[model samples]
Target: MASNHHRLSGAPVAAAVDSAAVRITGLTRSFGNRQVLDDINLTIARGEFTALLGRSGSGKSTLLRAVAGLDHGTVGSGEILVPERVSLVFQDSRLLPWLKILDNVVLGLPGKDARGRGRAALDEVSLAKRESAWPHELSGGEQQRAALARSLVSEPELLLADEPFGSLDALTRIRMHRLLRRLYETHRPAVLLVTHDVDEAVILADRVLVLDDGDFVQDLRIDLPAERDPGDPGFQHYRTTLLGALGVLPAHRTKEQS
Candidate 1:
């Protein structure tokens, strides 16, 4: 596969007015004869939080990797426009066991105040006191928190997360959800979170997208209040709509009803 991805910049004045944090046009990715993405076009506004949901092999991670410029084998005719500063968080924390928590956060970070910024990032994730601890010393959730700090230490303009909380238990996932929301608000970075959990998407995203068969099938804006509760009627409404788009009936809804 040959890469067709390029950096986007130098837009005209009118286009600059509507500039996006991440813009992908006519993007497609294929492995062998199977296409993962099919001429998909997407634009995420500055500081907008967008969640992507899809079943396995639906190309969620492929799209994210394309934007992050990590898809070396990507072959398609498309243009991806993203800020120079981009950070990615995966399902695993990916921390170096040999490095201390603070060092892990600041790894590869440049500048004289890198250490100070690393400390501040750790503080934001509530891991300030664990700066000297090793990755193995922290719990599963704490390690993920450190990973988040590492992503934010550079103050990226766009943050891409691929199931960053998938490994945690139910309670830890909820806590991480709240923490991610707070960080998003404080940092105001354009975020694209790839998740399988519909509830998580509805809780954290300003807009939700459903991808199926290598194309985006639904684009729904989340209009719920910031303080969302799963039991709220509005929350349930969005959740149901998204679930329906993914071709899954709600647990309470039966095939006979449909």
Candidate 2:
């Protein structure tokens, strides 16, 4: 909700929360002597959608893994407060070869009624009909939907997504984005998505943070309405700024997008 300038644009949108959702203070990570993250401080609000935007090797994914407890000792000098039950959606499906789509989702569920919940998740992603099919039998989009369902089945408080839709084609990716928004709207989980696409972040995230070499280079809020058009002036301005923040230039603009 604030920029790097130590100035408040307006009052924080989220308040009166018992938990910080996911808080990281002075988080740093290194392999050998090569530092990946350096003094990263981030606070993800409860039930908020935040996108981590950066080019390859920006350490955004590393930060997500550290919070998920997957990075082990790679994280350095940081305190990550997250729920015990965490779920992550990777770029690949990682589905079981023998299990069906529904079964894959139910993997994280408790023994009592995992099947029912899995079926519901598939229905949520419009993949209910494919529940009985094997992972190999599903299309690429369907496979990604199954992966999403698997991650959300446990209903974790913090969702770590690393390019969940990167493998899909353009149309499929757009549909997946719409589906993701609907799911996030319903579940209201604190989400941190690591993506290389600035446009995707602009369209889906409440706020976008651009990272460079494991440090936050630009912190910005999408200020445009939720139901904003990509061609709208405000939306375009924010997108232009974000792309510029990532060091990407507009197609026709002469000077760099500043």
TM-scores for every candidate against the unseen true structure: 0.90, 0.87
The TM-score measured for candidate 2 stands at 0.87
lDDT of 2 by residue, 110-202 (tens): 877889988988898889999999999988988999998888887777788999998999999988888888888888888999999877898
RMSD of 2: 7.0
Candidate 2 colliding pairs: none
lDDT of 2: 0.78
Best by lDDT: 1
* Candidate 1 Cα errors over 4 Å, as ranges: 1-18, 250-258
* Residues forming the 10-long window of minimal summed lDDT in candidate 1: 8-17
Lowest lDDT 10-residue stretch of candidate 2: 2-11
The residue pairs that clash in candidate 1, if any, are none
lDDT of each: 0.86, 0.78
